[model samples]
Target: MSTDVAALTPAEARARFRDGLHVPTSGWCAGYAQANLIIVPKDYAFDTLLFAQRNPKPCPILGVLDAGETTGPLLRGGDIRTDLPAYTVYRDGELVETVTDLSEHWRDDLVTFIVGCSFTFEAPLLQAGIPIAHIDQGCNVPMYRTSIRCESAGRMAGPMVVSMRPIPATRVSDAVRITSRYPAVHGAPVHVGDPSRIGISDLSRPNFGEPVTVPDGTIPVFWACGVTPQAAVMESRPPIAFGHAPGCMLITDAADTDYLIP
Candidate 1:
């Protein structure tokens, strides 16, 4: 019998991903946290760090692995290059290719930054009776590059990216209150309702990830996304960089409660 993907432990989930099970990670490892990945040469590490510091909403960092290091407290007994379901490679401001593993591209000077992902807070949202449309539809949460620009650091500069979830109008306040408690993982909705206000012309056409259905009476909610770093990478034209494919995050051993306030 096949194991339930949602019920798998963090390590088990990563093991499957390491073995080439490609899938979005929004609803996996329910209570554990999920993180976004960004790898860059050490020469550019300081800029990446500063970028996260300057734009905490969209780039709150969970943990950073030293240059050339992989296994760490957040992801014990695993390789950073292969643990995530999928990875996007970039070169000189252009998305080059995506791969399941980075063994071939690994370099001694590369540093890995694990940024906070909103998916970490989804478990709490579900526990509070807020429905996550992507999870319900078995698809990736919709994400788009917003007109809001992040506070840049050194060569790191780009527009902010956001992930969208449709919340029932009746529960929008509850959704905001619940998520506001976890600032480390994108605290609250950046924009609620009206996608065009943020420069997103169509909900059906997302810059990244798959679009989810917005049920009637539900208002669209947008959260700062960790993919904001990848947007910077693209804008800055760093010679080389790597990031987790949107919605395909790294399932960390850390509990979601670690980021929960109160």
Candidate 2:
């Protein structure tokens, strides 16, 4: 049986998100930009911001919240405390729990940062006739940690993480051309063809997300993923860190078109 798509206005979607909803958010609240979120203590905020700026490919900076502030009025005027559907809380670099609300754990010295996600580019890829295998199969895109190193910032250094999509060899160039327009959301392909060249030994076993089919005529293409920041956070093992649960993103007021520069 087919599932009904959730009908949520932008406001309603934000409200649902804040209430701690952790379900996959794709195809819901269309036309809005979905973002990856990262929250850290005030002491580490500057270093994290610097890390994001230094490694824009995998950690595009979207919006930042001042220490102790939960509402990002400049970006969405939505309450960060309760706007996202789900959150992952980490302590000393370990994932302690995943929750819907941050009210109880909210601290006066906390700062929030939103990162650009590849979901922003998916709409355009579909529009251009590129098939996203995971979307077609109803699964999350496959992600892997690579040997590629990210520029270090304080305690935020780690290997880059990337998301993979299989594309017809004939359409590989087209996918790159279309996505390159939106550099903020990890534009263009990082590697196409051999997965092992990037240290991904097995396509069937991804570090995060599910693997999708790669038909005989298709090749696997990789892109910098927002998960890179989370991985960095994990490696850094800060006292406390928060991130949007995988596949659960912050639907923002920004239009996808705004990201296209050319």
Candidate 3:
């Protein structure tokens, strides 16, 4: 059986991730927000920040680290280079390797960006009595690259990426309402209902994360995803980039409620 992840504190979660436990962060640290990691060479940092600003929905930046720094004030001393359970290294737009730590790959001129993750909204949805299928199934939420293109920022330009969940038709509105309050965490559904409308042919096959069952009477709901930046990396073909493995996020000290809008 899997551990009781939902009950772990942010520190405990980071410890587990740093210790080589590659677990999906869907329901961990229930009231805290999980963040996507992006490490870019100093030369590409400005364009990357611009890319995020232009595409806030898919790339809501929560915190950024100074060049060569491994910790952020809001991340509770967690090392950006090793706190995430797994990381993907991209070399000129191609995935090079997935590793547990960046000690060997760390650079003095690299900057880290922490982007808000959709996982932040999962807890609120469950609190409102909505079921997150992937959590129950012990899998990562399914994600896909859409035909929709993101606005260009310098060398960063590519199609948008989205994460999908199956929400019962009756609770779709509630899910939207709950998520909308957290704009810093990829707010609201970008698309609801037909997957084909967004150029997603098969729900079973996702560009990232795992697919979950879409029960009867439930419709597929899509949200802007942090993976959008990874797609941009592929398009822009930056010399090198580092990002968290899909579903393996950095659990931050910040609370999810900090992102809720009045």
Candidate 4:
């Protein structure tokens, strides 16, 4: 007999993470907002924020925590240092380490920013009767670094990264309509039909996450991914920076409906 892990509320889920749970918690914490996290020293905060603002398609700004503050005032009461399941620490653009907790490296001059995530838009896609192949296969969403260039901000600039889903041609418009309501979380499809159009030469391989099958009658659809910030930060080669590991997002108390602006 198999026992299912108990579902966790947003606050409880965050507490579980702080208590040393480093696993992906996306499907577990339903209905709440899940975000891509970025942490950088105060010196680079302005430049990073500008980078996100300028490339809103890939780096949608959700909530920014002040330097020395761990909790997000606008998003939730959650602690930034502990709420995330896993964190990737980068030194001079190279991934030096990954840790479950950031308390040891926490600094008074460090600031935290939570960007919108595609997970926020997935709910509506499923609701609209579209099938998410990767979710069905229990694998991570496929992500790619495109030839697309993001507008530079100071020293922060790099190629746009995108998350892909194979949707049936008939339902592509439905996917677009459902996701369009949530602009803050990379709304709409960037490219459809041809992967080569966006510089993705192969469909079976991706730079990040596992690739899913592109079944018959289905076409690959792309969206601006939160991972774009991670790529940009790496190119900028900051002395030290932190980001949530791909697929392991920071769950917030905010509802997806709240993100839809009229």
Q: What TM-score does prediction 1 earn?
A: 0.98
Clashes in each model (backbone N, CA, C under 3 Å)?
0, 10, 0, 0
Reference-based TM-score of each model = 0.98, 0.93, 0.98, 0.93
1-262 per-residue lDDT for model 3 (tens digits): 1347778889888888888898788888878889998889999999999999999999999999989999977777688888888999999999999999999999999999999999999889988999898987778899999999999999999999999999989999999999999999999989999889999999999999988988998989999999899999988999999999999998999999999998
What lDDT score belongs to each candidate, Candidate 1 first?
0.93, 0.83, 0.91, 0.84
The lDDT, on a scale of 0 to 1, for candidate 3 is 0.91
Model 4, 42-123: lDDT tens per residue? 9999999999999999999888888999886543677788888899999999989889989999999999889999887776
Ranking of models by lDDT: 1, 3, 4, 2
Off by over 4 Å in 4: 1-7, 74-77
* Clash pairs for candidate 4: none
Q: Which of the predicted structures, 1 or 2, would earn the higher TM-score when compared with the native?
A: 1
Off by over 4 Å in 1: 1-3
**Once model 4 is optimally superposed onto the true structure by TM-score, how far is the C-alpha of residue 117 displaced, in angstroms?**
0.3
Which residue runs of candidate 3 sit more than 4 Å off their true CA positions? 1-3
Measured over all alpha carbons after superposition, the RMSD of each candidate to the real structure, in angstroms, is 1.5, 2.1, 1.2, 2.3
